[model samples]
Target chain A: MAESRHLGDIILKIDHISLSFGGIKALVDISFQVRRGEFLAIIGPNGAGKSSMLNVINGVYHPQTGTVTYKGETRHHMPPHRAAELGIGRTFQNIALFKGMTVLDNIKTGRSLKIKPNFLMNAIWFGPARREELEHRRKVEEIIDFLRLEDIRRTPVGMLPYGLQKRVELGRALAAEPDLLLLDEPMAGMNIEEKQAMCRFALDVNDEFGTTVVLIEHDMGVVMDISDRVVVLDYGRKIADGTPDEVRQNPEVIKAYLGVGH
Target chain B: MIYRETGQYKSNYGADEQIFPIRQDRIGVMIILALAYLVVPFIGNDYWFSAILIPFLVLSLAAIGLNLLTGYAGQLSLGSAGFMAVGAFAAYNFMLRIEGMPFLLGFILAGLSAAAVGIVFGLPSLRVKGFYLAAATLASQFFIEWVLTKFPWFTNYSASGVITAQKMVLFGYAFDTPVSRYVLTLVIVTLLALVAKNLVRTRTGRDWMAIRDMDVAAEVIGIPMLKTKLLAFAISSFYLGVAGALWAYCYLGTVEPQAFELTRSFQLLFIIIIGGMGTIVGAFFGAAFIVFFPIFLNLFTSTVFAGQLDPGMLSHLEQFVFGSLIIFFLIVEPLGLARLWQLGKQKLRLWPFPH
Candidate 1:
């Protein structure tokens, strides 16, 4: 497991990040770094602070204690919108698609960040607004094609199957064209085939765009198969962080996974 | 075959993004507009034009405004009547205070005034949501109505708390004639509806919908919730305000503070709920239901049981029918007439082919 020593190149540095809800500590002094163009999996038992870590990274929960440095900039109390504006995109553990909107429209919503046409132009239906809308639509269609959602492009996301809905969520996150993508349990409820398709899409996204991915996954097989590194958490602390092989062999991770005293 | 889009090629983005991409819809809209402008005035009598058409058009405009806020933006507001009162009172003050003020200018100023009031009232939405926010809007409704009734200055120190509108002229022609008033209202309603339709298709409209759907997710996605929600309030109030001015100046010609009351807000809310909440066309549908149904009911009651049924009985019957209809529509199709229209289209698309 010596190859575990080189866990890609570090891209996101989380330093002493801690979060608490009144008396309960969700995450306590947890720190981790994700490498550029790397797939980092965060896995833990329920209430083990895995999701809290993702929330801190995406600015959903502001960490009370340390700084999150992304691309060498120290992020302090930055809001989710600011994080999104700085090329950070994320999907929720629960599906967060605009339910009433069509797949195309939902994906198009992700491109809202890229659209800079002024209100006057949009109000008047002028040249620049029309051009920008068309351009953005073209890009969205490309995403639709990439995600193989062409048939259901005009169908409402609410009516789609859960698996396709998850894919659409991924398409939506990808629509933002973020440098760092966060997926909160992308394959939580999926069957094996759906999981495979989602993993392939994740790999393609990483390989094609060279984007950094931080995923919270419970499926160890999927995590070990795709993740360049895996960070194991237990009781609001980072119990282990290394290559999948090293984390798999770590005695503490085994005890946490098995629920037995070492 | 009647509603087909075959052979209709959109070569560019402009063509594709046109408000009505289907040529038939555009052509149908043009024909309807022409009919509204040219034909309605010629056929309608004075009572129809003055008592029915003008009021219907004005109320329809107000309903459209409320629908934009309550339906599209997902912000339930009970202050529509108050906003309308603001428009009416503001327009009155503007007209009476300023010498040689144009009739159009009074309406414009009134709309702006309503927008200001609406923004102030909408502040509570940032801290509250759903039923709580709705209850807060009720405060706007009560407060504005109280001001309109209490302040003698609003009614120009009149003891009766009523104001009569002066004769209105746009350019050279007076809107004194019923035909001219009807035509003017038709034109204004058409223009405003077009503007509203276009508004919902843009960034601001999308922002409103985003906030409506899920404010938390919208904020995370970089939509400024406060700004977007406030813009919805302002625009919606502006439309309601203008409609209010038109209601007073053109339709009533004499107005009292009691004219825009809590009952008026309920009427508008019912119109939207019965019409279809989020769809633009639902405003007109709801308005027509609220306005014409009552008239039709009265006429039918008087005609069918002339001198047989008591007046109170007839009123009771009307109320029962109205309440039942609202409940029936809500239960059967909560999406309103818009869903029915979509269903009809879908049926037509699959015509001659059985499942």
Candidate 2:
């Protein structure tokens, strides 16, 4: 699996992050770094705190003990919306598309952060708002083309198949043109063919756009095939962190998988 | 075949983003506008102008206002009448107090004033949702009405909290006759509806629909929930306020608390329900049904009875028929008459093909 690893300077670093709900601990003293333009996968059994790691990275879940550094600035608590503004986009573990909206509109919402039209301008739909809207529409159309979603462009997300809905969610995140994309179980409910398509798109997104992607999933095959690096957690603690080969051979990840299957 | 739009192709985003992109739709709207501006006022008499057309136009405005909030934003509100009352009284006061205040400007300020009140009432929606939010809005509606009734300054101490609406004179021309008023109402409603139709396609409008479909996901996508929700409230009230001004000045010729009561609030809520929620054309359908169906029923009943039935009993019969029709519509086409209209258009788009 040796290829041109597009790893550059470390763009995002999480240091000793710990999150908890009341007496329940979600993550315990976890640390990881994602290099620029590389696919990083977080994998573990159920309740291994893999999803929590993604949440903490994007500030959706505040850690009880940790700091997140992006680019150069280290902030103790950057709000999730602020992360979005800083070019960090994300998808939920469960698909969360606007059920009533068409596929194109879902993707267009991604460009909303970049387009800054005042309320008055938006109400009138002229001047700055019109221009900005046209500009964002072009960007969204590009994403729709890349994702091969031209057929379902006008279909409501609710009526689409589960697999296509996931693609639309990915298209939405890509529409943001984010520097860092966070994906949570994107291929969770997909079949073998669907999983292969998703894995291909994920790679294409990273390669074509040079977007830094951090994905959390239980599918070791997809992880090994697509990820440049892998992080293994067990019982809310980071057990192993290394290249795909290194993580696959790690005794701890094997032991943890054998002990509890999820 | 005559209304076919198969050859039209949009080449740019500007063309694609138009409210009516299909060639047939654009031509249809243009023709409708021409009729409204050039033909209706010439033929319509007094009853047709005031009792039917004017109220229908104003109710459509109010229905659009509620649709933006309750339909698009997914925030239930029962205080629409209260907001309308605030608009009526506020506009009345602006005309009474402001020196040389232009009629249109006075109405605009009144709309802003209603928006301010709407924002206050909408604050509770931040914490509560669903049924609780409706209760909060109902409270605002009642509270605003009570305040307007209790304070003499609002009505200028007129008998029974009633203030006669001032003449709407813009650009040195007084719109006094039913024809002039009808034209004025038609122009105002058309302009506002056009603006509203465009607004829902914009970024802010998408934010509202996002909130409606799913609020948590909306927030995760960087949509500021507070700002978007409040803007929905403000803009919705602005439309309602303008409608209120029109309802008073152009239609009723007086501002009275009795006209904008709880029943009127429910009537507006019904308009969105029976017309179709979330579509601009739905508001007009809902308003027309609410306004004309009863009048038609009364005329039929009198003709059948040969003018023998008592007037009170005839009124009750009209009420019974109206109530049953609303129930039938809600049961048979919960999506509303507008959805029916849309289905018809879709059929026409593929007329030769059965599909």
Off by over 4 Å in 2: A1-3, A260-262, B305-313
lDDT of 1 by residue, A59-110 (tens): 8898889989888888866688888888888888999888877788778778
| Best-fitting candidate, scored by DockQ | 2
DockQ values per model? 0.55, 0.70
At residue B221, give the lDDT of candidate 2.
Answer: 77
Candidates' TM-scores?
Answer: 0.96, 0.97
**RMSD in angstroms, all models?**
2.3, 1.9
Clashes of 1: 0
Steric clash pairs (candidate 1): none
TM-score of the second chain for every model:
0.97, 0.97
Share of true Cα-Cα contacts across chains kept by each model: 0.37, 0.63
DockQ result, candidate 1: 0.55
DockQ of 2: 0.70
Q: How would you encode candidate 2's per-residue C-alpha lDDT over B74-173 as one tens digit per residue?
A: 8999999888888888898999998889999988988899999899889998999999999989998888878888888889988778899998898889
Give candidate 2's TM-score: 0.97
